[model samples]
Target: MCQTLRQKHNLTVRRQDVMLMMADLDPVGIEQRSRRRFVRRVYHSLGPNHVWHVDGYDKLKPYGLAISGCIDGYSRKVMWLVCGASNNDPDIIAHHYLQCASEFGVIPKLLRTDCGTENGTMAAIHCSLRSTHTDDLAGASSHMYGSSVTNQRIESWWSYFRKQNVLQKDLDECKEIWNTHTIRAVNQSRCPSGKPDAMYALPHRFNGRECGFCISQENLNEFFVELTRSTCGDGQLQAHFEELHAQSNLTTSYTWEAGVENYITLKNMAHI
Candidate 1:
């Protein structure tokens, strides 16, 4: 049916497009029911601050290393990536989150991870959340607010990234070099379309100016704080934190001790 439609309309009918067309063609009552279900599922998946998706990939190698990565949904940024010999634990995953939090001065409200042994373990998830200062604050804010998980977005990104960077069949040949180069390249590259809405507008409406590559960390923090306070509340600078806190699952004033510790450590190292 999709092939026929594509031929008739001179359109490339992808799976999702075909699904949408089918839903539209369904009986009115059925369409409504399906739409409701879809909406419910989507709403349930997004938390307020940021939703992170983590996954591990087995490298093609005699080296036998595994690579893990976490991506932020809103900014479409690669938060963290680590390569290690063992894929049996969540230490790398937790460390990745810590790195992201320190870099951005914000914590993810919900984390979406695959149902693998390393990711799905109760101990891993608990430790991942409990060990971080940002997580503690995120938990408190969530308790005073609300939060959710959306795994579909991260899964979609994974598919796209694999297709673009790692879909080669000859994984054993140039895999190590390719993996390292590709990961680094992807991180440094800017999205061709530019940032969503371009937080800063052009000086003149008609005149074309190239958008800047990055915003300073201080400015970014200020922008985020203002956005959070305006959108959520003065008390909680993160919407997801507030959402989860409202649900009584998180606290409101947890310490960011880990963040502080890392910052001090980095400063000292820089001095040396």
Candidate 2:
């Protein structure tokens, strides 16, 4: 509310002031929970792209849909969020991640995720990339870290997502909205562009580091092809994966015309 007032309305009200107004609007709902909870602890990261918290939200698993996303540790900006029927598939997860990296033009220095198979393919590539840096100055560390509670940055956003999206919504539309949504800076300082798009592109506004590092197209293609073979057959799925890589622009949409229905049906049945 404070961010909206500052960015959209050009008002100068403080966040505490907005909270007071909201409490007055709903006195009962504004009361704090009486239940005991863990003491709030804060974690810090060096800057944007230094660490990313990635996880899958499976509340829509029964409906053959799930969401996977990454959020920057320092800026609290979402790197990318993808909703799909094949969210459980390692290759699909890896593809969405690579596509995000391609669009942003750099993969993060570290990726933090729970120990899930969905992250297996991407984790392997991150490991291989780090291994290439035998020299002391390479400074390539493990891309993935395993701790769900430690990933509260992105985890906290899920609660609000659940509240706002009470019904089924368009996946692409949800992605667009999340990407453009404005957020308050860590210090609650007003940023000219509070939206994630601006925060990520202009991290300097928050005195954060700029995104640095670009992955080559060839390496991306190799990783996907290798991951595809490990997860599925060398037939239709492989062809579709290659076609995605061949596109001049990585954002081009491609559907698994051959096997998506069956895959989704089987996945949904497993949950049932």
Candidate 3:
């Protein structure tokens, strides 16, 4: 609070004063109870893209909407956050990973995700690409799977997600806020406190390094071909989805409300 005021308004108030004012303004938030946990896990990451944590947020699943995301373990930058119809689908989740890698033109040295069946396709793709390299984190070792709760970085972030909002637009706006917001330093932690996007873009500024690996253009193309086959049902499903979209009267301009409305309409039409 103090830093934000100083940076934006050129005000120099003590931290305590700012805290008190904020407390009065948001008493419920200030008095919010902390969740009790058994352990405080201390983790280490070599740098941005050293490890990418991927997970599914299911709070909206009951509404026929799904959210999937990936975060940088080192800088806590949200690599991607997407809302879709079925996060449990292997191809859908894999598409998220592939899309992110293509956009950034790089993949993490290692990927971490829970051992859910939905991650099977993503794991295969990561290993297949990493196999081209001869690094220690290549091949089948490119991804790790374990319990979802143990994927602490993204797990904790989901709690904040629950408190804030629940839509694709909300998720996108929240992701922007998260990337630009300053993080507070914690004791015994090597990760520096700073805006996530800045830390990721300039790792050296925070005594960190980049561990991203470049993707070969040929492999990227081939993978896209394979992904289309797996996810698009050989173009028939793609055409059918387009028909449904048109029937639902949805435009390219999307919102959570409209998406749910479309889903419900389709469900009713399908007699499901």
Candidate 1 residue-wise lDDT, 35-113, digit = tens: 5443333222222234556666664223333556665443344555555444545544554444455575554555566
Tell me each candidate's TM-score: 0.36, 0.66, 0.78
What are the lDDT figures for the candidates, one per model? 0.41, 0.63, 0.81
Best by TM-score: 3
**What does the lDDT read for residue 154 in candidate 2?**
76
Candidate 2, number of clashes? 1
lDDT accuracy of residue 182 in candidate 2 = 65
Q: lDDT at 202 for candidate 3? A: 95
Using alpha carbons, what is the TM-score of model 2?
Answer: 0.66
TM-score of model number 1: 0.36
User: Which of the predicted structures, 1 or 2, would earn the higher TM-score when compared with the native?
Assistant: 2
lDDT of 3 by residue, 1-272 (tens): 56547654578888889988988898877766333234576788888999999999987777756889999988999999987667888988888888899988899999999999999988999999999888898999999998998998889788867865667777887787788778888753578889999989999999999999988666776666344442333366556666777776655536656656766776676566
Better of 2 and 3 by TM-score: 3
lDDT for model 3, on a 0 to 1 scale? 0.81
RMSD in angstroms between candidate 1 and the native structure over all alpha carbons: 21.1
